[model samples]
Target: MTDHPNSIHQFKVKLINGTEKKLSDYKGKVILIVNTATGCGFAPQLKELETLKNLFKDQDFEVLAFPSNDFGRQEPLNGVDIEEYCAVNHGVSFPMFDKVMVRGSEAHPLYHFLTKISTPRWNFHKYLVNKEGEVEDYFFPFTKPLSSKIKKKIQKLL
Candidate 1:
C-alpha cells in the first residue's frame, strides 16, 4: 500500500514464461506499459510496438506488454498460448506478461494503479512511465506506438 500516485516500484508481474519480475528491476528505464488483446482490432499495433523497440534500442526504453481479456473478450488465449501467438504472429521480441484482466475488480495491481490515475478507454491502451517510476501520460487504444507524439516523448525521455 503506497501513497505515492506513480510509485510502481512495489509491483511485481509474471513474465510470459511464468517468471516473476519486479517492477523495480526497470527502475532506470522509460517503460511503455500497454494492455493488449490478441484478437482485437488494435492487435496490429503489436508490430508497431516492436518497431518502436527496435527504433529505441540504444536508449533506455522498453515496452512491457500485458495481455488482457477485459475488452470484448478479445484476448482468449492463456499465458502460454498468448506468448506463442505473439511470437508467431507478430514476431514480438519484447517482454510480454501473463494474461491479466486490465479492468474490473479482479484487475492486476499495476492496472489498478494505471486506471486509477487514467482510465483505459479500450484494449491496447498505453501508459508511459518515466525512469523514476512516474506516470508520464496515457495514450488511447487507437494511438499508434510509432506515432510522432510517442516518438517525441521517447526522445525527450531518452
Candidate 2:
C-alpha cells in the first residue's frame, strides 16, 4: 500500500466536512467505493451501504460513499447537507465525501486511480478495493448493493 503509481492508498480524499483523509490510513481495510447521486433512482441503495457498514463495522471494512453530480445533474446537495439528506432519507451512516466528478477530464484523482480499467457508467456504480489497495472487482449501477454477489465478494474480501 505504499505510493506505488497505481496504488489506491497513495491518494487522499476530502470528506463532506472538508476534512482531509489519507487513503493510506485504510491500508489494512477493505473498501467499497460507490459514486453516489442523491436524486438518482438508485438512491435507495444507500441503505444497503449503511447495512453493509453496520454488518462489518467490527471488521476491517469500510464503505466510502462519494457524492457525484456527473450524471443527470443529480446530487445537488453539497457538504453536510448532502450527508444529512442521505442519512435522513436512506439511513446512510457510512462516511460520505465532498461532491466529486467521478469521470471525464475533471474526475477526482482517486477516480483516475480507480478507473484504470473502466469508469463508472452511471450513478451508484461500485468498486471493491481489497485490503492491499488493489481493485478486486467492480459492480455496475444495475447491481443492487444488497445483492448476494456483492455481499459474497465483500465477505470474501474480509
Candidate 3:
C-alpha cells in the first residue's frame, strides 16, 4: 500500500484479447478506470465512454474498462466474448482489460489499489487518475459517464 504515484505500474493486467498490459504504459495520461458489467443498469455507459474517448482524443484522457461479474453476476462472458460484445454492441474502441473481480481478496491489484484508496460502491464505479497516476476522484455507478461533473473533472485535469 505505497502512496507512490508509480506504484500502479507494478501491476500488470490481461487484455480482452489475451495480451498483457502494464499500467506504466499509460503513465502520462488521465485515466478513468471503471468496473463494468454487460447486463447492469449502467451498461449503456459503454457508449458514453466511447463518446468521451472520442471527444478527448486530442487530450490526455483515456477510459480503461474492466468487466466484472462480482456484482449480481452481470457480466458472464469471458475475455474474447466480452471483447466482441463491446465492439459490436457499443462500438467501444477504448482498451478493455480481461474480466476481473473488483472487490474482495481476489480482486486484481489495480482494483485493490482503487478500492483501498476510494472504494467503489457498485458496478460501473469509476476512479479518475491524473497524469502522474494519482487518484483524483471517484464516481459512483449511477453517475453517467458523460455527465457534467465528470466532464468538468476531465477538463480540469487536461
Candidate 4:
C-alpha cells in the first residue's frame, strides 16, 4: 500500500515501553485499533485479539491495543504493570501502547481523529483501518475479535 501524503500516519503515539512512534510506521498494513481495559468484563477478549494478530500479522495485519482507563477506571495498571499482566495472564504478544484517554478533550490525537468518525462507546471498542489509512469499520465492545463478520472483513482487506 502506498502512503498518502497526508493520512493517519501523521499521528503519533507512545508505546507501552515509553517510546514514541508515528502511525506512519505502520503504513500499508491493515490495523485493528482497540481501546482495552484490563479490569473490564471484556478483558478476556485480549486473548482472542492476540489470536487475531498471530493469525494475520504475516499478511500485513497489525493489532494495536491501547490500554485505557477512561471507562470506569477499568485499566489502572501502569505501563510496566500492564505489560507484565498481559504477558503473564494472556500471553499477549501484540503491540500494547501506553495508557491513553479514549475520549474527551484529553484524548490522544489519533483517538481524537478516530472519534470524529465513531467514538468508542465502551471498552474494547475497535476501529479497523485499511492499508490506505482509512477507517473501514467499527466493532462494538462485544464484537469478538475472531467473529465471522470480523474475519470476513479482514480476509477481504487482505
Candidate of highest lDDT: 2
Model 2 scores worst on lDDT over the 10 consecutive residues at: 1-10
TM-score of 3: 0.94
lDDT of 3 by residue, 85-110 (tens): 98899999999999998889998888
Superposed Cα RMSD, model 4 = 2.9
Per-residue alpha-carbon lDDT of candidate 4 for residues 68-157, written as tens digits (9 for 90 to 100): 999999998988799889888888989999999999999987888889779998999999899988889989998999999998898898
lDDT of candidate 4 at residue 110, scale 0 to 100: 80
The TM-scores, one per candidate, come to 0.95, 0.95, 0.94, 0.94
Where model 2 places Cα greater than 4 Å from the true spot, the runs are 1-4
lDDT of 4 at 98: 95
Tens-digit lDDT string for candidate 2 (1-158): 34445668888899999999988889999999999999999998999889988888898999999999999998888899999999899998888999999998999999987888679989999999999988999999989887999989989989
Provide the lDDT at 131 for model 4.
Answer: 90
**Candidate 2 similarity to native, TM-score:** 0.95
Q: CA RMSD for every model? A: 1.3, 1.6, 1.8, 2.9
Candidate 4 Cα errors over 4 Å, as ranges? 1-6
Count of backbone clashes for each model?
0, 0, 0, 0
What C-alpha lDDT does candidate 4 achieve relative to the native structure? 0.89
* 39-101: candidate 1 lDDT, tens digit per residue: 999999999999999899888899999998888999989978897898899989999998888
How far off is residue 119 in model 4, in Å? Answer: 0.7
lDDT of 1: 0.88
